[model samples]
Structures are given as C-alpha cells and as structure tokens.
Target: MAGTAAVVSFGTASAQTAPGPAGTAAGTTITNTAQASYTVNGVQQSATSNVATFVVDLKANLTVAPLGGNTPVSIGETDAVLKFTVTNNTNGTQDFILSPIQSLLGGVFAGDNFDVDNIRIIVDSDGDNLYTAADTATYINELPADQTRTVFIVANVPAEQAASLATVTLVAQIAAGGDVTRQGDALVSNGLAANRDGVVDVVFADNDSGFGDLAFNGYGRATLAYEITTRNVDLSIAKSSTVISDPVSGITLPKAIPGAIVRYCLIVRNATTLTPARNVNLTDLIPANTTYEANSITVGGIALGDECVLDGLPLSDAGGTVLPVSGITGSYDATARQVRVTIPTVTSLLPVAASFRVKIN
Candidate 1:
C-alpha cells in the first residue's frame, strides 16, 4: 500500500475593508474544502470533502470628536459655528444620527453661564472644514468604514449674552446603512447571541464617551464651549453750547442776541470696557431762526475743561474740505438744516467732540 495524503484549501469571499479580524467585511462567506488523492492499484483516484462556510459578523462603532477647542463668539452674533468630526469606526458602511445638546452643566468649561440661540445641526457635504450654506445635510450619510466627516453646530448668540460662556455637546448614534437617499433606522446590538450562518450579527465595541455617553450603546458624544470675547460698548452723547462773539459782547459772557456767533459741541463717549464703539454718526438739527456759519463744521475735536476748542480740521457746509481730519467727516444739509459728523470709532471714556458754529438770525 502506498502512502496517502490529503490537502485542504480555504477560500474567503470577497470583502470590503472593515474593523475586525483580518479586516473582513460583514456577511462575507469563508469557505474551506479538503481534497484527497491516492494511487489505488497503480491508478490515480481523487475524493473531495464537504465544503464548510461561515459569515463575518458586523462590528458597530463610531466616535464624535471636537475639531477645535473653543469657539469665540460675540453678543448678538448670528450663525456662529462649532465644528466637530464624526468617524465611522464600524465594520461596514454606516449612517449616523446627529444631535446637538446644550449642556447646563458648567464643568465642561469654565464660566458656562448661558445657552446659545437658534441651535442647528449640519453636516459638511463637500469635505471642506468650514461651514457654509452648501453644507446643508442634517444627518450623516452613508459613510464607509474608517472614514471621517466633519459636522457643525450653528447657533446665534443672544443680544444679552455678553461676557458669558456656553457649552454644547454633539452626539452621534449609529444607524442602518445601505440607502444613500435617506437615513436608516438606529442600530441595535445583538449581544453575545449565536452567530447565524450567512447573517451579519451586530456587536457594539465603542468605548464610553466621557460626556455622559455610555459604551456598547452604538453612541458617541463630544463637548465644546462658546466664549464671548468682546463686550458690548455703552455709548452716551452730550451737547453743549458757548457764545464766541456777539454784537454787544465779544468772548466775554456773551448773551444770546442777534448776530451772535454760537459754537455747539456734540461729544460722544464709550463707557464699556474691552470693546470700542464703531461707526458713530452724530446729527444735530440747526436751531430755528439761526444760520449755519460757512466752513464752521469741525470734527474729531478734543474737550478742554468746559470749552470745545476747534483743534480739528474745518469742513465746508457742502461736506468738502481742503484738509480732512483722520476718520472724521463733517457736512451740513441745506434742506434739512442739520449738521452731520461721522466718526469712525470712539474707544475710551475720553470724549470725541463734533463742533459747529451757528449765527443768530
């Protein structure tokens, strides 16, 4: 009798890359067969063993991570974005349902004292990290295994939320994948159940996220803070008048008489700290029965004691001047009988003055 030998060959079905043993795709069939060949009476003969097969199980996992540390916002600001990244750690294609939760607990960030307004959840459709109108998908679509997508939590800052901080959390839940046109149902894990042949079994392997999201629940979460960096400025205006000269007295206790030249000063001050007043425009209607003096409009003047010295450049009544003050413009409206002064900014408690002269008619 001659020696007999048997050979076995194992074949695994084609599979997509996934997070599992040998990176095999879920529901893929692995087959193995044994063949025996031997010489019987100097003739060659062959026999084959039964084929055995098993399917790959599914591993459902995902994670949500904040892309940036803190998002700085301003009071009354709109469309402020807080970015995060969603990664599909599942063993197959998966969809994710996104939820943005406002955290009242302040332990996530220091000084979490407020909540943002008009909160919205958006997914990045174009792979760009920035938030825009084009990024309109509300839920994560079919994301392949080991792929990551960016998401945004947009909100509006309330007008009263000044110098306040708020915290927000982004939560992602694993859902059914396969359809590209719509979101699938939320996935439920089949825990420690017997693996069925040719059927994909679900297993949750995600770790417990520190932000109140538990592990093996097919869910993940991350938190971020929105900080108000700039404070709202408080502005107040004061107007005063002084008689420069008159027909009766000149530069000395001048009375309000005919042909008297009266100088008016409009001062604007910002009382808030850490923020400056911008685009400050001052308008004053010329007093009745008075004529505006030609080239008497001056802006960016300083206040000395109780007098407004026209140390700034003078502007004509028509809004033109040979020399213009820095970031200051003055004009007189002929029809409205008003004096207009535009100051670019007022930054401190020190007042900025807009001065003009009118003669009693």
Candidate 2:
C-alpha cells in the first residue's frame, strides 16, 4: 500500500506540477511514522520545486545629431540632413517605431520667421528608401540587444522662411511584442511605449553690420531785410505844347501838354544763416490819374514787361544763355546775399506788393 500510495502521489504531482504549482501540502500522518516522514519530505521538496517567474527588463538608448551639407541654414532654402541613433538595451532584440515631433526654435533671431515641411526618415538598413508603411517588413527587422542602428533624415527649409535659428524634434517608440522578456519560462512585455524624444537647433548671423550712422545737416535759421535806393528816373518828351486854330475860325487857341517818366530802385538782403540769398520783387501801383505818353520801360539796362521784369541787366552764363534765376520773376545771388530790382515807370495801375520764396539750408 505504501508503494502504491507513493506511485499515485508521484503521478498526481507530476501531472499538477509540470507547468509549476503555487503551493505544496504534506499528507496526513497515519499509524506508520516512516510514511509520515516521507509525506513531509515530499511536501518540502514540492515547495522547493515551485519557481518564481520574473519578467525580462528591457531599456532603450537613443541619440540625435544634426547632419547635412548646409548645417547652418539660411532663409528660404532647403536640403539638409539630420541623423539619429537608436539602440536596444535588452537581453534580446527589440522592434521600434520612430516618428517626428515639433522641435523648438533656438539662437538669436530664432523665431523671427520660419517654416518646416514634414520630416522624412530614411532607413539605411532597409535599402535607404523613404520610410513608409509598406516598408514595415524592413523597419521591423530585429535590432540585437545591446546593438545600435543609424537613421538618416532629410530636412528642407524654404528660402523665404529661413531665420537665425530653428529647432526640430523626433520621437521613438518601442513596439509591443518586440519589447518582451522571458524569465523562468514566463514572458513579460512593456507593450507600446515612448522610448525617446530629441531636439535640434540651427543658428545664423546678421548680414548688415553698420547702416544708420551717417551725418546730415538740416535747414538753418534765416534773416531778411530790404533797402530802397533810387526813387525816381529822368524822363524827356520829344514835343511840347503848341497853339492851333480851327480852319473856319480866324482866332487861334493855346494848349499845354506834358510828358514824363519815373523809376524806382529796391534792395534786399538775406541776414540769416540760411545760405544763397534770394531776390525780392516789388511792384509799384500807378495812380489812376497819372498819364504817360508811352508805357515802354527798362531796369538796369534790361527791358521790362507788364507782368514780370528782371532785377538788373539780363545776365548770361558761360554758355551764352540767360542765367537761371532761383525766383521765377525775381533774382538770386549766392555771394552778394542781396537782390536789387528797379521799377522804371508806373502810371494808372492798382496798388501791388512784391512776393518771393526763400529756403533755409
């Protein structure tokens, strides 16, 4: 019976304990002490046979580095490269999924203005084609534990959107089944999880150094004055009064007639610091009752007109043409800082005043 009981116990225990059991129990004591001792030993042995299972510990290691022909980007341009390294730090291989996140701007003028297109990930291990869902077979390839993989990325910046500095980010995740560990025939998995996040920044320098440091002089204060020189001019008439009689009348009649001319002179000066004195024009109003035989007149040897007259004689430049005057109807002198105009004759005209313009410089 003892041998039979032992055989039955062994069979039952082997069947229950193949996969491992949580607890062990000793058989009840009977009249035979040897059998009880054997049962207690079996219980102790069973307890020792139970094994505690622990899940495998998995970790990820990642690094990011900027790469490209044009590392320091300019405004409104493209064609740059970014490199990243991913490592599996576990007892077994792991599968990973990498995606891009928004990077932060850095350096002076970093955020002045910028734009970025979608990030492109290239898996060199997978034949260097652009990463996409169809390429999952190549991307999911096992990265042996304690091993690293390099990934290449292409970055593009529009010429117009370039700035002094810019920032970018990338995200990496571990796949569910790929992140599992086996301890004592039990499996532990971390499921899907974010393994790493990275940031990168680019910088640029100012192009213009010194632009707004030139000196300039503005308009200065102006001084003005006027002087009247000669007040009149000599005049003569070809004929004098004469006596005449009507053909029918025998008696003769006497008549008195006269003719005369008047001239006036004017002087003006620029007294202010404003350079290049200008001419001041003056007009004399002839009274209505005044009479003149002829209206022709001259000033400083120059003929005068009813609407406008030169201040002095008609001056010419080296080219033989009339010298340009600053004032439309008046005169201007840079050195003399004065202007002079003559009114030769005035008769039966309304009161008028001279007007001119001046600039302070």
Candidate 3:
C-alpha cells in the first residue's frame, strides 16, 4: 500500500529582474490561476462554484375542502366524509408525515358521542405509476415533493353526543435533511353549538284520607300525601290542588264555629352535584261552609306567622306579610329555601276540606 500526500497553497508570485548596465531593468508579468477539486473512490469530481447561494423552502402546505351537504351527523356516528389536500414546496423531492395530534371528537358534553374511521388517500406523482399502502397511510405517511395528495377523514356524531356543540382539530407535518417543518392544523366544526333547552315534566300521585263528619263539639282532621316522580332529570311541581271538601252534618246551637283552614308546606333539595336554584309556589282552595282560618305553617324549621293565611281571611292584617299568603299564591324564599302557605278560619257554614297544588320553579 502507498501513502497519501495532500497539498494546500495560497497566493501568487511575479518574477522581477534587477537593474543591469545603463540602470535599465526588464521584467515580464505572469498570471497564475488556482483551482480546487475533490475526488471520491479515485474519481475526480467538479466542486460547486457559485457567487450567491439560493434557498429552497421545504415547508408543506395543508388545506381542508368544504364539507359537501346538509346531512346532520351526530356524535358516536362514524364515516362522516372529511376532504383535504396537501402540497409540498421545495426545489427537490421532499417527504411529509401526517397524523392527528388530538381526538377530532374530544371535549364533548355529557351524554354526547361521536366516532372516526375509514380513512382514504389519493396522490398525484410521477416515477411511481403504482401506489402502495406505505405511500398513503390513513393516519400517517410520507408525501413526495412538488406533488399534491388528497385525504379523507370519516367522522360520526352519535345521537347522545349530538346535543351539545364542539370543535375538532387535525394536523400534518413534513421533514427534509434531518430538519422538520410543521404545517398549521385545521379546525372542523360539528355544528351543534346551540343550547338544547330540554324540559322535564313532574308527575304527581295523590293519597288522600277523608275527614269524618263533625258534630256540635266534635271536629275531624284528615292527612294527605303526594308523591312526585321524574326520570333522569329533576321534577319541579309548580302548582296543584284537590278542590273537593268534607261535608259537615246537622248542628244544634248556633255558636261560633271556626271555619276550615288548609295549611301547606313544601320541601326542596338539590339532587345533582350541580346545585340548582329553585322557586316553589303553593296554593290551596277554600271549601264550602269553611272559613279561611289564621294558623301557623312551618318550612325547614322556619315558623310562619299568622299572616301566612292567603286570600283575605279574618285571621291577620291582610297586607304586607312576610310570607305573603294573599291571593292564593306564595313565592320561594331563597334564604330559607322553603315555601309555606296557610288559610284562615271562616264562619261555620258546613266545615269542609279543600285541596291545593304546589308549583316548583
């Protein structure tokens, strides 16, 4: 084996002659040119020579095509067609990789659902008449330079997920010469941005016991119960009533007989982790022969005063009561979180029982 020697030099030299007889000197100027070359595998190759260097932008551009029609696709539903195109801008061929950074159907409200599947890709390029699965990866793949490729994303919106509105984002990237360049992500709208405003109705079941006949010095009292029911959602009772009353029997002396008074009480509680503010109203009807009587009603341990009687019964001062039992209506107390209503006693006519309804707001 022979050793290798390398030579490196700089600058040029010119020859000069010293002055001869008659003090005259003659000289010739010489021009030298220097060149550098490189060799690989014993073959000499010309080096790149340029006064100014040009830059090639190897970034990829991605854009989404508008969705076709007005077919509503809900959450948890799949195969919804999404169209998009990708372009490479570079002097030479470049390869791009594409993938989803986040779930397209993420951030859905409770009870909302969606699905994504069935990805398809089409590429326009030369030198490869045939396309392979490696060329078009559904979720990830490489794209060639100065070329355009089309990708389809199928998404589904389920009925439960269809109620609330949401947004999904998709992204793609490219790399060249060990350097990576990323394209901006695209946003896809699910079109469910409005409030659903679903309402739930309250169902009431009644269990009432009759008040027996009252005599000269005897009075009867009855107990009534109500059950309210609702599915998944909370039920609110706004107002209710039982107009029927108990009839009184024969009496001897015309003494002062206290009229019938129906007292109402309401209890409300928060059923869900998300606490709700509620307004409850209770109303009761006055029965025949029964005068509205003044009485006390208690709610959540709060004692209601004589003013609790509604609709002008000779029980207490008729106006400006704390519990406003006037006009067969009463409002919910936010601070107390309960509702109480009382009816005043009336002059004895027949002593009958009355029914009423409660409303929750």
Candidate 4:
C-alpha cells in the first residue's frame, strides 16, 4: 500500500497506432480507430484514440487498341473486318457500349469517298482475339478488372472506288449498371445526393494513366480506330498518225501533206494496279480540214463488232475467249466533228488501240 501510494505509471496512450487502410481500390474508403483506457488506484483514466485511414480507391479505367493494326482492302470487298480490343480496370464489374465513326481519312476532318456498308459489332467471349462460333454478343457486359475482350467491325466496301484512304472508327462508352445493350447513367461526385440524377455509379481514377479521368460526376469513354486502304485504278490514252497515202504522191507512207490519208491510232491503257474498268468510253474531236474515215473502233487489236477475238486487238477482255466484244458501236458527229467508241469492258493486262483514216482537205 505504501509503494502504490508513492507513484503511478502513466500508460503511453495505446502507442497512438496509425494503421493505413487495406483492401483498397475496390470502390470505397475504410477507416479504423482504437482507444486506450485503464483503472489507476481505483480511478478510471482515458487516453487519446489511435486512428488509421485509407481510401477504397474504387476507380474505373478503360483503354482501347486496334487489333493487327491497319489493313489494305480491294474495292468491292465484302465483309471486311476491322478488329479491336477493350479493357476494364475498375477492379469490379463494368459494361461498355459501342459506336462507329468514318472521319479518319488522310485529312483530319474530310470524309472518304466510301462508307462501310452493313456494319456489325461482334464481341469475343472466349478471349481468342477472333470472331469465332464460341463468341456471340452484341456488346460488352460486366467485364472484370484487367481483362480484355475482342471486338470486330464487319462491313462491305462499295464497288468502283478509286485508290484512296479510308477508315473505320469505333467508340466505347460506359453503360449504366451492367448493361452493354444500353448506356449507363452519369456519375456525380456529390455522393448520395448525386444518385438517380440519371447517373450511374462509377469508381473514380485515383492515379493518372491517361486512359480515363476521375469520374467525380460523369461517365467513362474510349475510342479505337483503324484504317482501310484501297488500290487506285489508273487509265491512260495515247494517239498517233500513220500516212497511208497522199493525193499528190498517190502512195501510203510515213509523210504528212495535203490530200494524205492519215490513219489515226488511239491506244488506251489500263494499268495493272487496280480492278478492271467497265463500260469504257472514249471521245475525240476531229481536227479542222481533216475528214474522218468510217468505222474506226478496235479493242485489244480486234475491231468493234468482230465475231471473234483477233490478234489485231492489242488487249483482249475475253479471258482468252474467242470474242473480245459481243458488240461494238461507234458514231462520227459530223455536226460537232467528233469520234467516240464504246466497249463493254476493258482490262489492265494489255493496251487496246483503235484507228481510223482521216483525209486532209
């Protein structure tokens, strides 16, 4: 009793524990605290409380990328597929909606000559990075954190397009709840008061990854784009004249003079870089003081209306068929002094020439 009355030890306030929160980044912050108390000499004494705090760090991060990069396609190509991938980093469940854009041509804003037709969005459920029989979904639904889903944009290319650049763009937006079919509401940072503002609940990004921003009161979105290149169809024309005869010389030769019969040969060429040209059309203006000879149209060395493909034709569109042209027609516009030729089809493998004799007046 005498020793207890002499002195009392003051307990160090429970060591003032300061613990950092754990199981963070899920969506909410968890706080914890502890206090120290003791009975000294039959009297109760209290000490300051020890507290620890940590954020839940609940956050949503999204990223998109093209699969296999850009690609080159031919005109009239059907079911062209543009592939992409979407990833969710929310540490929880999330969904994404899909949208398309066509503006990413060579120019920043100018649209290309053609648009992708019959476009469809496909989801890769098996993580195979391919649109397979096992994968069947219209949109992404309730994806897990750090997981990826493959997507494909399938469409048709229009026929008869010149060589040019094109693009297939895709946009993704977070949907309300876990509905990939529909967009989710926006998230408000105002906490409980912000609920039901048509806004969906979303984890905000605590750190900066540039994929998305902290959603204080909004939704998350991302974009993935790909380019489609088409080959160019080039057509060229060449013209020359050969002297068949002269009124003064009365003989066919390589000389130009008054009364000379000039056989004009026009060579039309299609390069091998692109698809064949259909319904090829040709026109020429008759020179003054020159009279045009009648029926001067030829294709691949074969004359118009020829019953069979002849060696005389420089290029044959018959695919080795006996006849290059089923039918050929031409007209001399005497009123306008012009010559025109029409062919059903023309190929790029060879040059076709047409010649008509014109007499100098």
lDDT of 4: 0.54
What value does the lDDT take at residue 84 in candidate 4?
Answer: 76
lDDT of 1 by residue, 1-361 (tens): 0111111111111111123322566777899999999999999999999999988887787767778667876676678888888888877888999997765344445566788889999999898799988888999999988789999999988877444777777888999999999999999888678777778889887756343555578877767767788766778888889888899878788888999999998878888764566667889999898998877888667777546866456766776643544556778898998888877667775678778899998
Return the TM-score for each candidate structure: 0.62, 0.29, 0.25, 0.45
> Model 4: per-residue lDDT, tens digit, 162-218?
534455555555443455566455432334444332233444442322222232222
lDDT of 3 at 134: 40
Stretches > 4 Å off in candidate 3: 1-71, 74-76, 101-136, 139-144, 159-166, 176-361
Task: Determine which window of 10 residues in candidate 2 has minimal summed lDDT.
Answer: 1-10
- TM-score: which candidate is best? 1
Model 4 — which ten-residue stretch has the worst lDDT? 1-10
lDDT of 3 by residue, 90-137 (tens): 222334444432142343222212333433333323334234444434
Model 2, range 1-361, lDDT digits (tens) per residue? Answer: 0001000110011000011111111121112122222346456422233333332233222222222221343333333445445443333444555554333212212232343554465555554433344432323246664455655545565434223333343333433233333212212232334322121111111111111111111000100001111222222111111122223332234222222222322222223221222122443333343332121222332222222233343422111212234222333332343332333222222212222222211
lDDT of 2 at 161: 21
Question: In terms of TM-score, how similar is model 1 to the real structure?
Answer: 0.62
Best-to-worst order by lDDT is 1, 4, 2, 3
The CA lDDT of each predicted structure is 0.76, 0.29, 0.29, 0.54
lDDT of 3: 0.29
Could you give me the TM-score of model 3 versus the true structure? 0.25
Residue 133, model 4, lDDT: 60
